[model samples]
Target chain A: MTIPNEISGSINNIRPMSQSANRLMNIVADPEYDCQDIIDVVAMDAVLTAKLLRMVNSVAFGLRVPIDTVARAVPYLGERMIVGVSLGLCASHLYNKPLTGYESEEGALWTHCLRAAIAAREIARYANDKTILDVTYTGGVMHDIGKSVISIYLEGSPRKIVQGADSGKFTDYIEGERQILGTDHCEVGAAVAAHWRLPASLTAVVRHHHEPGNSPQEHRALAYAVHLGEFVAMMGGTGTGADTLMYRIDENYKDYISISAKELELVVFNTGQEYEKIVSAMFDGQETAF
Target chain B: MKTILLGVGDLGVTNKPGEELQAQSLGAGVAVIVADSRTGCIGMDHIALPDSTVSLRRAEEKPGYFADTGIAALLEAMKVFGSNISEGGMIVKLVGGANVMDPNSTFNIGRRNVQAVKEVLWKYGLGPVAEDVGGRVNRTVTVESITGKIRISAPGREAWEL
Candidate 1:
C-alpha cells in the first residue's frame, strides 16, 4: 500500500486561494464593492457566472421567474449566498478527483458534501438560525475535506484501512488512518481549514464534526448541524459509500438545536427534493472536460 | 407457571394471583414486560436498525414503516393495562436493542428502537425498572408474575435474574 505521488503532491500543495481568493480579491479590489460589482467580477468568468445563474434558477430558490444573468441573480440569492455558492463550486474541483478507498466513484464526496451543505442550510433556516446558515453551508461542505486528504495520503492503503475499520480490528477509522497513513483525515482537514483561515466556526466544524461531543458548545452546534445534515444526506442515498457507516448523528446534540425528531425528519425529507434540484441545476447546464 | 407473549404493537399483563411468571423470546427480538399483583403487561417491538431513531411523525406518515411509533403505541397500551391493574404495584423488566441490520452501517434502527422505548416509558412516567440492550447476541427475557423476578436467556450464557 503506497500513496500516489500525483495525488499527494496536489494535496500537499493545496493553497486555500481558489474560492476564498476570488471572494477576497473581489472584496479588496473594490472597497465599495456592491452586489453588482461582485456580479461583474463573476460575469467576467463566463463559466462561474453561468453556474451562479443556474443555481439561482434551481428549485432550492423556487424563484417566481427565471434568472438569466449574474446581475439578476444577486438580489434573488443575496450577496452572501452567491459568495457561498461560488466558494462551494470552487472547492468542488478538489473533491472531483478519483480516490481508491471509498466505494463511490470520483466526485461522490463532492456530491455528498453539497447535499450536506444544502441540508444544513435548510435546517438552519427552519430552526431560525439565519446568522449561522452560511457558516453551516460552508462547514458542511468542508467537514469531510479531511477524508479527501486522508484518501490521497492512503492512496493504496485505503482498502486495507477500510477493511480493518469495517472488521472493528481498529478502535475507530481515525486509528486505521494513523496505522496506514501516519495521520488521519481529521487532523489533515483541521490543518487545511487552518491554512485556509476559514472562519473559526467552520474550522471547528471541520475538526470536530466527526466527534461533536468533544467540541466546545459554540462549535458543537455547528458540528451538530453538519452531523445531522450528513446523516440526512446519507440516509437519502446521496453518498452510499463504505464510509457511510462512519457517519453518526450524535443524539446528545439534539438538545442544542430547536429541531425535534419530527422536525429533523421533515428537514431530511425536504432535503431529498432540494438535492435533486441543486444537482440538476448545477450539473445539467454545464459541460467540462474532466 | 404462566407466560404472556407480547406481540408487536400489543401489550399484555399478567394479573392473576399466585403466579410465578417469566418473559421469554426464542430469537433476537425485544419485549417489555411489567408485572403487578393484579396484572402483568408484556409487549414486543421490532425496528429496522438498533441505533437509528425514527420519529413518531415519520411513523404516523408511514404507519408501519418504522418501529419507534409501534413501540410508543405499545407503551400507551401498557399504560392502560397498568391503570386497569392498579391494585398491584408495577414492576418492569425489559429486553431488546440488537444490531439486526448491517453492523457496518451507522444507522442502527435497533438501538433507536430501544431508545424510543426508554423515551416513551419516561414520557409515560413508568420507566423500565431494569433492561438489557445492544450487543451481537440475541436475548430471551422472562419475569415472574408474583415475585417480580426477571430471567433472561441467551446461548451459552446462564439464565440471570434482574
Candidate 2:
C-alpha cells in the first residue's frame, strides 16, 4: 500500500471519525451538559447504546450486574467515560484494525490506546485537576492515531522501521519516522484530528506527544500528561512495540509531578490490571461496533 | 504449566517440575531470577532498586522489591530447594535489566538492576550461564522447569531458548 507523503493528500486515504461521535464529543466536553442529555443522545443511537452497555458490563469496568439501559449505564460510565466509549466505538474501525507499522500484534495499539487513556485520566486525578480528565483521556487514547496512517502508507520492511525507530538518539519517534517515512505518524495523527475537526487539544496532543516539550504553549500540560500516560503504559508492558523506550522523557517531569515514585509504581501496576480488563473488552478482533 | 507472574517488587518460585515462571515487563529497573536446572525449581523477582545503587531512608518491607533483598530471599529459597552452589548443579540465567531509556540519560536503571543482581549472585558464588540483557526493548522471559528450557522473547522477535 502506498501512503501519501503529504498531510493534505492523505485526507481521503484514511478512515474518518463518525459524524455522531463528532457531535457527541462537543456535548461531552461541556461541563454544564446534563447526564440525562448524554443519556438521551446515546439513547437515540441504539447501536452506541448497546455497545456502551456491553463495554460497561465487560470485565474492564467490572459491573456486578448487567446494565441493559443507557440511562442506568450512563451513571455507571460517567459523562467523560461515556464519551470515551462512544469515540472508541465510532472510531472502532480505525483503532481495531491491526497496524503493521509498529511491533504490536492485532488489537495491540487499541489496547495500548485505552491503557494510555486510563493512565492519563489517573494522572490528571493524581495531579488534582479533575476538570481536564476527559480531555486528557482523549489525548491519551489518540496519541498514536498517526501510526495507523503510517502503517497503511508504509513503503519498506517493518523490521527496518523498528530498527531505525528503536534508536534512542532521535528526539522522538516521529523524527525517525520522518527520516524513514517522509512524514511521521504524529503529523499524520494531527492532520487526521484536524480533518475530523475534533478539539484542538486533541490534535495538538497527537502531534506533539512524542515531543510534548515542543507542543503548543497552551496545550503543554495536556501533552505532558499524555506523554506520561504513554510512558507508564510502556513501562507496564502494554502496547510496548519496537520503539518502547526510544523516545525522550522530560527529565523535568519531577518538577511538574510531585508524586513519589513508590506511589506512581503502584499506579503503574494498577493500571496494568485495569488495562487487561479494558483491553479484553475493547475491539476483540471481530470488526463489530463495540 | 503453572505461570507465576512477577510484578515490581514481587517474587515467586516453582517447586514442582510442571510449573512455568515468567515476568512480562522486564526493563532496566526490573530483573528476572531463573531457576538453576539442578533443582528443577525457578525463583523470580521484579527488583525495582538495588541497595548498592541508592540509599533510601524509607523502610522497604518487601524483599522482592529490592535488588539486595530479592537476591537474599532467592538464595534462601534455593537452599531450601536442595540446590547448593558448592556441591554443583545451581546453573543460572539472567534476562532483562535493559537500559530502555535514552542512552544519555543519567538514570540507566537497567544497568543498575543488573549491577545489583550481579553483586548478589557474587555473594552466593553463582553466575548466569546465559544472559540477554541491557537493550532498549522490553523482554519477557519464561523458565519452564519441566522441559528445562528458558525462552526469551520480545515483540516482533521469535522466542529463543537460553
Candidate 3:
C-alpha cells in the first residue's frame, strides 16, 4: 500500500540511519563478510564503539572479563546484534517518544521495542533457528518503527479504534488503523525501513510482522519470530499502549517456528529478565527511569 | 505520601500511612492487591505467568513473576507489615489478567494466570473480595495502604473503585 503523501514526506524528513549503522548493515548482509569488517566499521565510529563495549560488559551479558575493545565486543555481540544495537542507538530519539495517539507515555515504545528485541532473540535461540537468531532481534527492534511516525496522526482516535476492534466492527487494530487512517503502522514502518536503506530481511519483518504468513517465504521465519516476540513483550506487560496485543496472531507461526509449550513459557520468562537488565544498563546514565 | 511503582514480575508492600502501591499497564499479566483492615497494611503482586516451573531458578530469583509463587510471596510480604492471614482479617482484590492477544488463541495466558492465582488463593482459603479481571482491556491497579481501597483504571475509561 502506498503511504499517504503527507506521511511519506515525514518519513523522508526522519533522520537518516547513521553511516556506521548503514555500513554495519551492509557487511552483515554479505554472506562472506568477515569479523574484521564488522570490527573496522564499529571502531571507525567512536560513539558506536563505546555503546558496543558498554553493552557487552553490561550486567545483562555478565561477562566476568570486561570487553574493552570494539574488536572483541563485535564478535561477542555478533554481527546482527551489533547491527541491531547500532541502528537502535542511532534512532533512539524516534523510539523515545510519548506516542500520544496511543495514549502511551514517553519511553513506552522504546521499552516495548527493546523488550520485543530480547524476546525475539530468546525465541529464535529456543527454537534452534541459529540462522535467524540475532537477525530476529534486529527485526523486533525495528518492527514498530512505523508507530513513531504514525502516532501523531492517530491522536484522539485510539479509543474509537480499540472499541471498534473489541466490538468486532474491525478485524483487529491493523484493520482499525487502515479503515480510520488510510494506512497502518506496518505499511508505514516498511516505508521507513526502505527510507533508512535497511536490509531486505529487516524490512520484511517490519512490513509483515503483524501477519507473518503474508511475508515472503524466505523471511517468514524471522517475521514469525518477531511477531511472537512482540506478543511475549505485551504478555509481560511491556506493551506501548492501548494497541498492545490488539493485533491478531497468525497461527501459521507454528509452521515457521517450532517451539513447544514449555519452551514458549521459558521464552516469556527469560525475555522479561533480560529486558529489565538491558533497559537498566542502557539507561544507566540517562534521565529515564525504567 | 509515597507511591511505589510495581513492575512486571515484582511486588511491593507497605505499612506506612497514606502510601500507595501501584502496578501500571498490565496486559495479560495479573496484579493482586491485599489490604489488611486491622493493620492497615497494603501490598500488591504483579504476576507475569501462570507457573513457576517454567524456570524454577528464575522464579527463585523473582518469584513475583509467576502466579503460584507471586501469591505466596505477596502474602509473605504483607505479613512483614503485620497483616493477618486469617479470614476476614485481610481483604483481597484482583485486577488485570486480560487476554489482550487474539481471543481465539489457545494459549490464553491471562485466563491461565487468573486460574492459577485462584487455585493458589483457594489453597490458602482466601478469595478475592472484589475483582476486575478477564477482558481484552489493559488495566492499571493501585491500592491505598491506609484505606484499603483498590482503584482500577483503563485507557479511555474513568477510574473505578474495585
Candidate 4:
C-alpha cells in the first residue's frame, strides 16, 4: 500500500516531545542552570522525579548505595547522567506507544532504546572515549524516534507490518511505509533529532543506525556502538525479534573499537544484567509519568 | 565417514582456524555440520541475547533453557547416527553464538550456551578441528565431508571458508 506524499511528509515531520521534555531540554541548555533548578523542575512533576530516582538507583548505574531522592541522585550521578535521566524521563511517554512496521510491543522499543543508550555508554567507556557518553546516551535513546512517527502513521495497520516483519519483508514494509506515509522512521527520527537541535553525532546515530555504512566518519563510532547495542538487544529478545539478524557487522569497526568476540560476549552478559535491574526499577516505582 | 560439528560462541569464533558463521542477528537460527569421511551431523542453535548482530529475549519462564538445547541437539544427532558413519576418518568444525539480546538484562544464556557446548565436547573427547562462532551477526554454516571444508554466510558480507 502507498501513502500520499503530503501525508508521508507530515509523518516525517512529527516529533513526540512532550511539554516536560521541552522544559527539560531548556534546563539542560541553560548556562546558568543549577542543580536546584533542575531539581525544582523535576519536583514539579512527581512522576518524572520518581522515575529519575528509580533509574539512578537502578543497577544500570552500578550504584553501591540506594538513592532515595532526586536531590540526592544529582551529586552522585553528576550533570551528564542527570541529563540522560531527564531525557529518559521526557522520552518515556513516547516510548509507551508501539512502533508500527516493527514487531516490538508496547515498551519494547523503549526498552531496546534505553538498553542501546546504556550499551553505548559502556562501549564508549570501554573504548576510553568517555566524552561522548552523554551524547551517546542521548543518541541511543532517541535513535528510533522515527519509529514513533511510523507507528502513528501505521496506527491501524500494525498487523500488516507484523506479518511483513515475520515473513522477512521488513525492508518491503519500510518501502511500503515510504509509499503510504511519505517517509520511513529512520529519516523521521533524524528529523526529530534535528528539531531538538541535538548534536550532529547524535543526529547521525539516529539516522543511520539501521545502515551504519552510510554514517560519516566522525559519527561512525557512535553509529557502530548503537548498531552493536541494538543487535545485542534484539538477540537477547528484550526488544525486537530475530527478523533483522541477517545484517552484517563492519569489520573496519573492529580496528577502532578493539572489541573482540570475547569482549562482545562480556558486554552482552554485563548489559543483560543491567537491563533487568533498570526495567525492574522502572516498573517498581509508584509513579510512571516518564 | 563420520563428522562432528562444533558451534562456538562469540569469543569461541575469534580464537580459531574454524570458519566464522555470520548469522543475521544473535538468536537467529544456525546450522552446523560435524562429520568424518562418510557421515554428517547437523545442529541448530539460537542466540538468546543481543550484542552486535541480533536481539532476542530469554524465554521468560526459564531464562537459560535454550543453552541446553544447543548441546542436546548435537548430542542427539551423534547418538542417533553414530553407528552409520565411517570408521576412524572424521572431521569436526564449529559455528554459531551471536549476542542478540539486551546487553544489560539479567539473562546470560548466550555465554552459558557457549560454555555448555565446550563442556559437552570435552566430555565426549570431540574437539573442534576448525570453527567460526560468536559475534552479533547471524551466520549460515555448512560443512563438506569430502573436503572437511566449512562455508559460512552473513548478510552484506562475503562468504568465506575456514
The prediction achieving the highest lDDT against the true structure is 3
Give the TM-scores of the predictions, in the order they appear: 0.56, 0.77, 0.91, 0.58
Better structure of 1 and 4 per DockQ: 4
Interface RMSD of 1: 11.6
lDDT by residue for model 1 over A199-276, one digit each (tens)? 667777887876777777666766777776776665444552445444334666545556654555456546655566
* Docking category of candidate 1: incorrect
Per-residue C-alpha lDDT of model 1 across residues B1-162, encoded as one tens digit per residue? 756554322344444545443333222235655555444444334332222243455455433223445545544555665633335365555675543233333334345556666675565466777777655334556666546666775432345666
Per-residue lDDT of model 2, residues A258-284, tens digit only: 455445545554565566655566544
lDDT of each: 0.57, 0.68, 0.82, 0.55
Fnat for the candidates in order:
0.00, 0.30, 0.39, 0.21
DockQ of each: 0.03, 0.29, 0.49, 0.12
DockQ of candidate 2 compared with the true complex: 0.29
List candidate 4 segments past 4 Å from native: A1-47, A54-68, A74-82, A128-130, A152-182, A241-246, A285-289, B1-162
* Candidate No. with top TM-score: 3
**What is the TM-score of each candidate's chain B when compared with the real chain B?**
0.62, 0.83, 0.93, 0.52
DockQ for candidate 1: 0.03
Better of 2 and 3 by TM-score: 3
lDDT-wise, the better of 2 and 3 is 3
Q: What are the clashing pairs of model 3? A: none
